[model samples]
Target: MKYIFATFLLLNTFHLFGQESAPINHELSFQFDNDLLFFDAGDRYYTNGLFFTYRQKIKEDRSWSNLFGFQSLHKSIFHVAFVSKIFNPYNLKGEKAEEIDRPYAGELYVDGLYTSYWGQNRLAVGVDLGWLGTKTRSDDIQTNLHTTFGWVRPRGWRDYQIHDTPIAHLYTGLSREIVSIGPLSLISDVDVRVGTINTNAAAAITMRLGRSQPLDASVLTHARTGERIANDRKCKELFFVTKTQLMHVFYDATIEGNIIGEPSPFVKSAEPWVWMQSVGVMLSMKTFDLQALWSFLGREVVGGRPHKYGTLVIAKRF
Candidate 1:
């Protein structure tokens, strides 16, 4: 933690040198999805997710860039994130077996995304590559964290984890704003992912009110622009948003286990459909942007309990 603080101070020293329209912006963000923020029991299916992300602009013209013709787009960016997701069953103290509501599993992966934008719309493609099961070290990370914090020791994860296996996933997303009314507007989004780790499709609609930049280059929607010197805008924004989402599942290795290799000792049926509701707010200053969101979800597996998680994001612009 101290090392991170030192690095932050070092970067702040470059604020002046970072003044120009270099046609690039860098953001480091940390996201935590956990039910504890809502003061719930906090342990069970879709238990917790932690991610670290770094994003920056990509140049418009490189031999490789020629493939995308990025100059025609409003903005282009490349971002990478390290993700850790843990899944727990209804009973953490029970003996490991198929009798549980869900299997014990963990995923540790690195994902990269490329995104391009046009007015009020954006397209994104991404890939996730890494390991699933015991190799992800979820039990170790969780145990150490819990012990240090005096939280309950996750004893059952070790006995119940799925066998180690490799994973790969490909995904794409598109979003567009279909209506606008001064401070209020509506946006629609659709996304899909397919691979060894997870296969699913989702559609969402969001209504936002208050102040914001256009969708083509607004940080609120993660459509950040690399084409302008951020300070040049001098816009301070605050906005409130609400969203509804529905998803259909095709496969979920986290619960079903990988289809091949040494099969896990246990697996379960993924729910065919799930619903989600979210409410959030975004606040932006020249130095940083802050977002806070809370989400409630219908069960992801048969007979599973409903769940909720909170997200907080702080992004620096440089």
Candidate 2:
């Protein structure tokens, strides 16, 4: 952890001192998802969680121009995130609770990405390094469990846990706008990941409605541009967005079924695939953006119930 911090600081220093033309952007955001808000019918796949992220972007030209000074050579992004996850109601109460609950876990990770663009299409490669373990307090876990299940007995110190391990994941993604009709646009994206502990692939299609014009080329390709520089667009805009995705999981090292000596014995076998659909609205202005999305997920595990979750994101850019 100390080394990671040191590296981050060093990189930031290089960014700050390198060149005058280099531009940087940063965003702070929070996201939360819970099953209780789904109105009691939804359950498995994922339960409830909170995630906080800090992201920094450096423009490609500037990065490449300052490469001799330890600057990046491609459009680069760095992210730091904190995550917390809580178990579902059924996992908290059944006779097999101790073996299946998983209770809760806390994780912290740092991610780095390098991206390149061709017209409106983008290609990105990234890696995530983190630590995941059963560090969340049992009392807090019980409180959330009670909130979701109501009047459930606390499980005491008996809980399931994944053995602490450093996580390393590498991935690549491609995204592009496929079509446009007036103020509406269609976009597609696909991503694949392989890690020391997990492997998954996903593809998604999305539609955006109500923009006066298509997103700027830089924004479309997630690159830095004069629009981000001038920062003159204080006028707010509203849009409705919808997305559908298909995902497949080949393995998960954190789940008990895939790792030896894992204390959380919830799943005896891995579920290979899942599907998700979401609808949302986005509001964006000069320096602020907010989005609210409702999502439905298909069954991820055999006999597991399909579920619904909501995500709210608020971001401030600088």
Candidate 3:
């Protein structure tokens, strides 16, 4: 952990010193998921997890743009970030947990993206590198600790040799404003991801209704890579936003294990389709932003049950 933090600090320092004159924005946010919202007694697939993300953006029009030749490439902005998350599966909880064989896991991801805008439309392309699964003995220890603290009875020890894998993927997404009527505007977004390990595609349409003058188009889209800091000085706004998204996955290595190998105990026959419907309200001011969303998720496998989760995001901009 120390090494990871040091590396992050080093990269941040480099970017800060190298782009001293560029307008930079930094945002940090957390996401928590639990099955209690769905009135379930025990945690199962997609159980409790906490995700943390740090995002930093550098404006392309600044002096650092010359160093990166971004203008020459027609890119409007550069973004780099890191994400870390710890998630536990069904086996980590309860006395009857042995029925489910999934193991607790940790995920570390690093991504960089370039974005460009044309009128009300925006495009982003990025590459993500992820390390999924337990990295060391300490990871398992921490998982046990977290489970214990959460009031789950800890299973003494178990085999986790089948875990640990690396993932590399490339993704591109587009966001566009479709129409506007009075203070309501409709925005559409599409994201596609393909990699050696997993492949998925998703699309969403959102409706934003509020004071038109303070609503920033960027806030209506769900793609975090495409999000941008509003440049206008008057940033106070409140918007009621609702979005529905559908996603289909050709493959998910995480659930099914590696694509090339024999299946693990946790592997189930892959289910390629899923859907999510979300409704959220966002409040943005000059210095901070807050959004609360409730989402309903469809079954990921043939016999699986649908679930619901809530997400709250709070971000401070500097």
The C-alpha lDDT values of all candidates are: 0.77, 0.58, 0.58
Evaluated with TM-score, which candidate comes out highest?
Answer: 1
Looking at model 3, which ten-residue stretch has the lowest summed lDDT?
214-223
lDDT by residue for model 2 (32-94), tens: 676555565343335566766776665545644233343223344555667655444345444
TM-scores, all models, native as reference: 0.89, 0.73, 0.72
Predicted candidate 1 versus true structure: per-residue lDDT over 114-176, tens digit per residue: 887766787889999989888778888877877898777666775567778887999999889
Angstrom error at residue 223, model 1: 2.5
Tell me the deviation in Å of residue 14 in model 2. Answer: 28
User: Against the true structure, whose lDDT is highest?
Assistant: 1
Candidate order by TM-score, decreasing, is 1, 2, 3
lDDT pick, better of 1 and 2: 1
- Sliding window of 10 residues with minimal summed lDDT for model 1: 62-71
